[model samples]
Target: MTEPAGRPPAFRIADLIVAEGPEGAERILIAGLTVTVSAGEIVAVLADDTGSAAALIQVLAGRRRAQYGAIDAGGAGRSRRIRPSLPAGVSVVAAHERCPDGPAHVVVVDATGTRPAESGAKPAHAAARRGGAVLLVTTDAEVAASADRTVHLNRAPRPERRPKAAVRFTTQALREAAAGSLTAAGVDAERAALVARVLVDADVRGHFSHGVGLLPMYLDRLRQGGIDPTAEPEWSQEEGSVVRLDARGGFGQVAADLAAERCAERAARTGLAAVAVRGNNHVGMLAAYREHFVRHGVVGLVLNVSGPSVAAPGAGRPTLGNDAVCMVVPRAGGSPLVVDFATGTVASGKIRHAAHRGERVPANWLVDREGRPTTDPEELDRGGAVPVFGGYKGLGVAVITEVLAGILAGGTVSPLVHKQRAEPERAMDCSQLFLALSPDAFGNPPVEELLDVLSGAVAAGYPQGPPEVHLPEQQERLAETMAAEHGVPVPASVVEQLGWGAVRTAPATAGGTA
Candidate 1:
């Protein structure tokens, strides 16, 4: 790679996080870095530590601003840190890693449930077992052989004399490149760009799902003639409470966001508003849609439907959908109580994450090819099912999501089947429903006042120190503050995975700007 002229001298900057050695010891390091792939190209960085894998995702997604040089991020700008609440389980992995092994699960279970004593069953059994498509993570090889395209990311030593600034692509540039790549593979440009944007933004939000992890899937769909590029949302207002959208089976997030925003507007006027979107693709992160309602001070609820990708209760077959539900309520001084989660015990992405590192998942979390309990991640990976969270309860939520989000919006998924059609980007015909309610619509109460009441009660009920009870998104704010003042703690595994080592001292610079 040619170093750009007139750029400032490059210094090694910490980019990735690494978890190394046995027992997963963690560390953070900043190593010299360079992008070897060409623009519009896809590369997979094979490394240890899923966090670093996720961080590399941030670099690719255009979320992290290039600290050293300019990089293209499609047409979108760097994600604005709104200082909103992080999702409920956002920091669970980090906490789990740090928690004492003896009583960690019990304490977490006690705090997370509806009631302190409501530990109905182990969380492994508490998750809903529904059927639907799940996003998975795998090694570069698996992605390359099974997936459509794989971009290889390998560590490269930086030159002793670094360029002043590294050239980067903008979101628009990435969109154009992705669209062209899809088009070259016979996919439509406009639709491809929409999909690219959603996937990229996921990376920006630090979510592996719906991010670069999906590039291979997108390419596969393109190769299979699955997506129609010129597709757009077909909009129509059914009634005062209903807004119907047909995404023409294009991009899921774009359609879902549009529908959610419309619902928020309608809800603001009326007490309740509902928007149903059909023929859309795999909309990544239902939480993103919830964020819209939270920002508008509207209580938001969302349901997304998928087919037999999830496991059902008592039944061995994947009967229920990986139906996901999201709820976001307004809050004061922190992010809204953002609740985003899948009904299943674990997301397929996490399973893929473990698989990528050649790790074994917890025994209870898996089932055999015949759908019995097992610790083999591969069984689940290769065509297996995960039991519902708590037999009937989890299945119940799964049913609810399917009905409200799928059937209500006129989408169907019975037996899970991967189809090749020039329609949406995922699942046969997925649908999403957004419902929003403004606090004022109910009784004309001040949002802040109401927030104060709810938050105060919750806080007073559980004082600090004894497993301090925090409202949703509260802990994330604390985590963010710690990160801002001290810096986001990068595990050692993550550092090596990104091929960037952490630096604690400033190096003497060449004839570069101060």
Candidate 2:
């Protein structure tokens, strides 16, 4: 095809390396880079940081000179302009969602930043419309598929930076602080203590994503009256082995605990029992509630719908909740076999914390609204979604839980709780299902014997890896024991956030199994 009148050929660069080679070079910024973008074609560049991205953009726009190699910027004349920002006629959408007016010579879509600040701006399409080239500057896993080509720079890896020192709190002091804050936030004395215990336990279990990181929002919910601190769950309905509980929008941990206790009692009599919980709040981890039944030598299963922050595989949008499932069975000679997991491809909390720490996520775990793989955790808030775990199988599990826990319990489901998030004063309006089964009911053989053989088989094939082959609760119990001896550490920032001052370095004897 003939070039348009007065339009220069597509911009091209080759054998490029940006460094301080002209003088006292401290370090190399980019190395062995090559890029080519035809007029009316878009190309994406994935880099580690915005500063390096900006530096490359300046070189391409003829604002700065590269230490090595060549750049043919189409017909754009060269200049030594030190523009702190990108050159004119080049659009750059950074953390702020603002977009430039018309298409320019080049466009850079900054996909790294806080999630809430990113709006889905189709940079490639926008550039294509103006018969221009787009250079997507991002660390995100993918640029738009419309890219004519991608240029990956081969820079020497930087030294790993040490994380800043953190404030630490003993297990006892942290729990007390959490309880006090929840109490101040209007939770009943007993309920506040229970919630604190659940949250603190999550930290000890090394599940920081589900730990006290949730306290601020919980407190806000209390302030908004979305939560009834003194709310008492009632047994709304009961059959021989089936029970329904009304949490009245109270803390979900309290509701789950109640359900566990009741389900255990009913299973003891009937040999099998189930409980449905409605109008609950954040229940922390289902493993906690499942332990209640495992302690009683009853097999246990618990299921709950989480925040609708995940997307179904091929849903083209964020549609699925972070549903969770947990099952535990008692063993006579060993810790109970426990399995627990969320249906989201990855825990959303990990994404949240990664975004907080300015870290990238695994690409396979997330997809942008355009169904492009994304490592930017920020995309989760920008109309992107975490893919369902196990693909359609994970979605199937989520649907089943919604029916068994949501619909069966006569609580919220469907569009009601589909996109809803739990607030302090606002009810999650979700439901939870708990099932307990006693082996005595079925004249079952000794499960411990079977488990012993099964465990032995697994341990026997350890291949000299990871020291010891531990079953589910085995490692957790060991971690708990160590944490018990050497108190769990709570972030000092978390302590301050909870209004706990005057840090104490004493060893703490907080809640832990004997």
On TM-score, the candidate that comes out on top is 2
Give the range where candidate 1 is weakest over 10 consecutive residues by summed lDDT.
128-137
> In candidate 1, what are the lDDT values of residues 380-418, reduced to their tens digit?
656676666666888887777777887776556434423
RMSD of each: 21.4, 14.2
Q: Which stretches of candidate 2 lie over 4 Å from their true place?
A: 1-163, 356-358, 418-425, 459-471, 489-493, 505-514
Could you tell me which 10 consecutive residues in candidate 2 have the lowest summed lDDT? 110-119
Q: What TM-score goes with each of the models?
A: 0.55, 0.66
